[model samples]
Target chain A: MTFTLFDNEERMAGRAEAALRDLDFGSDEARAAYSELLDAYRKSLREQRRMMRLGDRLQEQLSTVNQELVRRRAEAERALQQLRDAQDSLIQAEKLASLGGLVAGIAHEINTPIGITVTAASILADQVAGLRRQFQAGTLARSDFEEFMTTADEASRLVLSNANRAVMLIQSFKQVAVDQTTADRRVFELKPYLSEVLTSLSPRLRRAGHRVVVECDEGLEVDGYPGALFQVLTNLVMNALQHAFEAGKTGTIRIRARLFDADTVELRFTDDGNGIAAADQGRIFDPFFTTKRGAGGSGLGLHIVFNLIVGTLNGSIAVQSQPGEGTTFIIGFPRVAPARPVAV
Target chain B: MNIHDISRAPTDRSPEIQFDPDACSLSISGASFPEDGAAFYGPVLSTLDEILKALDQRCVTVRIALNYFNSSSAKALMNLFLMLDDAAQAGNQVIVNWFHAADDDTMKEFGEEFAEDVRFVRFNVIPTAVTS
Candidate 1:
């Protein structure tokens, strides 16, 4: 085992042999020990590299799972937030609707008295002017005085009635405004509810220069708490009149309701004004979502309307609109009127 | 905002909630499951109470005709039903008819639940529709 390969390349071979001898491979035992040490060193180096690679892969997988978890959690939170926001908007819309109904009814109670008072006041003023003329012409007498007194009294009564009517409407409005039934339920009528709602919204609509034309099927009836519907309609109509038509411009709002198929009552409101945009259609019903930002638009109007129709009314409402065209809202109320209508 | 309450009519999604006063008659129909069920149905219950208290006869006919309502609204409906039932127990003939679709077993079950809470108020579950 001590042979040297220095016959051909004697110089290079002699250097290798010397180097190998310097490694101190003396006997079989010493050689085996050196080889064992070298093999252990190489194995440890390979193991460390393999461990590092495995650790890198494990960390990458953990990071991916964490990212997925964050994404899913964010999605869940978004959904929950949306639900909460929608619920809140729904409550607001229902409250507005109820108040509208009450106001409309109260307004009906006031109209007659106000109308009569206005007429009486006008007539009395005319009579007073006539009396003053007669007196100025030196033709006034005791009979004339008595007539004037009678006229004055009548005028005063008319004034009082008119004032009372105004007071009632105001009171009704106040009641509606301050109503805190974040939760309320009661049974009310259709006609009076609608009437009150319209009356409540009179000023708002009038201020917007929009006119409402109602065509209710005379005998059409259903059982629903009208306040929510009133709010829903008020918001929708006012939205069309005020926002869609632009302030100071006049538009026609048509409200038509009829019993359909004996099992559903359909109420359709169409406005001849600028309609909603196509892009805004899907998001119109989202809470706090609006195209009109910073114009005092809370973006809850349509959201409320949606809640009122779907939540309160337990009905379906759909919107059709085109920019620069007109918007139409169709509401389907399931069942109104008797299966057997009484022969009126 | 006074409570806006109505008894549904008899139908697939309706109840005949009626307030028949000597002065006027009030009826409610359609579905009322306000997102804020409590807010929507709250004033209605109170207003109804006021109206019923002021009426000549405590006996008012209420109909509820709702096609769909959420769980929160179901509570409100139950509250209304209980109120009517109480009025009936107090010597008033309060008739409550729970309406549903014949094919709608869920609604029928709902009607039955509402019917269980009555002593004197006549509770009737009527499925007027042939199919839900």
Candidate 2:
């Protein structure tokens, strides 16, 4: 283990000198042996220095690699964070796109009724103008007057009915559309609000032959973001329509709500349709998982629902279902939702 | 020798990467993002390595259509393109097609960036119609 016989070459040289002085220099054999030993010692020192240099170079290389890896890891983390943000914004965009589609459908629905009303009103105006001319020129007849009155009454009725229909459609659209676009908080009654949401979704419901009934206690009020609540309900209703019911099959969606506590509310949405299979029930909330791939399903419906409930409404959701027994989604949240919704 | 296809489904973060070894085609579509870009691309790089090694001077075609990809993914892609370049330099035929949506200036720029370092491989920045 004691590899170094001397601390330095000076000590080694002193030792060698003392040994030479004590040795018999007259013997050539001894002189030769001493010279060989000196050569071996010098070679060992040279080898040691070379080994030290190699070790230093290896350490430097390792440090460089470590630094490169650290930099790369940090870069990867930053990229991942950026990707997450991009994905989140895209999800938000999908939500807004859905709202846009709903608005377009509502507009189309309102247009037909309003168009008929306009035509009826114009016809009635023309009749009035003609009748006024007849009266002023002293050419008015009893039968003509009676016919005019009858036409006026019929036109008035048509105008009134259609105008009322348009007004109702617009009012419903205004309420639900406003909630979809804005995240502002307000105090509102629950039962009527649910009614408005269902009315706004009538176009989809009718198309799918699905009926949604809301059962909430009267005079129950909540101070929170109705927009978030609207989104949650919309997603759930849409999910049931898309997943729970078979195509062209009529299904009943029942939404029952009650106060869970003084500050909390429980809402249960049950659909009497083909329920989710036991295996798929677990991953229904996973993003981009759809049994209806290549169809109209985006697979973000339930995921968005989960996010809105937990993130926006600060609530929890659970699902109970069997293949033939139908599906029920039970959601519980505070009556007063968070002032500002958090991003999931 | 038959090379199996390498396909990964798209997630909220990352895009789908698919390689059809029999067709000598590899495609990347959707969002190119993952928490560990290198790890995600590691198998891709290795797969390319295997394909190139067995290519025997045959042509390999790479088609890339990524709507969005982060910087880390960009790096992984750069490495992949370099590997293709090396393969081409070794006398193997490599053709790389970089597709970007017409309205996506960012993706166009990325295609250009990847194209800059490629010489041996026939690299082309192709403009595609906006999908959504």
Candidate 3:
């Protein structure tokens, strides 16, 4: 038997015509059968055509919706990236502002020793001029000359000591200032480096009547980013001075460092001042969270500290405090810091 | 009856077709939305017609499991069922199983609608836990 394929309505119609021709039209039964078959085929064809139109429309709608979703996803991703970039720049600005504050404090601190040295040198110059006059008049007694010698000796000694003090102040200030500005990794004795950071912050500490005591092994060395460490210490000390002690009240901040393990070192910074409230402890490290919102608190200090430790140094920090008792920040990091990703 | 088996592999836009001569079973599964539905289903339909003509009181089983089908494929499916219905009317046992995912109400409705049109074939609309 030959198969005639019915691939479309025209082919089906042609096949129906052929079947009608093969049938005996004189027989009523044959006519009725052909009529029934034609009716069913026409009904099915109508329904199929209706469904075809509906399917075409549905496909068009689906494609349009899919395109819209793709465009919206791209737009949302771009917006998120922009928000992250803005956040990074804000963090950088906050860090620079804190460094600027330290610079001002150190400048004021160096003024005292430098001023004393200048005053002593002026006194010595006046004494030498008087001695020259006395010797030229031919009326200088041995007793006067000996007394002048003693005064000259004391004045010279005062100038030498005060100048040396000024030099020492500048040296420490220079070290801390450079470290804070340039984020370079190096090996340094932890005790002396902490001392240098504290020295740079000495003027603010003295003004607030706060004393910082550092305790660490004399030979305890750390290979890490000193600039990040400087930022962390500066932020913690400033945070304490700002929120801890009341005006004109004296306080002490102690920083103790020890080896937690062969590979890790821990530093505990504790201040004997007002402690954080229990409710505020959880949000203290969050950006723009502060009890002193309008009272000269940018609130980014602790947030910056947290980011530097966790992100840059790959370290961990935790705070413990009780109201009216004190607050202690426990920081732990590797002895040799992990390699940081190169900046893009 | 020396009827050859028909087998068609599934594409991204079309369903798989399998016909077993020994078991007297035909199964079509997967999504069917071919660009040229008539061209795709024409050969299968001709082969089914030949198999039905060669049968002598043989029980033929047809199973369809579709996730989606365009209108052209739907038309082709209607023709296939009609042929099965004709065979059942001529004293042959024909069983048609329409399987749909339990969650797909549209496919279930399509099965019911198709069953209403066919009179002789034993049409069973089955709800399956998994969709093919």
lDDT of 1 by residue, A66-127 (tens): 88999999999999999888777665665566466555655665676788888888988898
2 versus 3: better lDDT goes to = 3
What would the per-residue lDDT of candidate 3 be over residues A1-344, giving only the tens digit for each residue?
A: 43222344757777887878786688888798887888888888777677776885676577579889999999999999997788778778887788789879877988887887788788888888888898999888899889888988888898888888889988888888777778788898899998888888888898878888999977888998888899899999989989989888899999999989998989999999999999999999998788998897877889988888887778899999999999999999888988872331
Give the alpha carbon lDDT tens digit for every residue of A155-186 in model 2: 99999999999998888788877888887778
Q: Please identify which of the two predictions, 1 or 3, would achieve the higher DockQ against the true structure.
A: 3
Interface RMSD, per-candidate values to 1 decimal: 40.6, 20.2, 4.6
* DockQ score, prediction 3: 0.14
Pick by TM-score: 2 or 3, better one: 3
Candidate-wise lDDT, in order:
0.66, 0.81, 0.85
Winner by lDDT: 3
- On the 0 to 100 scale, the lDDT of residue A84 in model 3 is 79
Runs in model 2 lying further than 4 Å from the true structure: A1-79, A125-141, A338-344, B1-132
Q: What's the TM-score of each model vs. the native?
A: 0.48, 0.55, 0.61
- Model 3 / residue B79 / CA error / Å: 15
Candidate 1 residue-wise lDDT at B85: 68
- What C-alpha RMSD separates each model from the true structure? 33.0, 24.7, 9.9
Residue A131 lDDT (model 2): 94
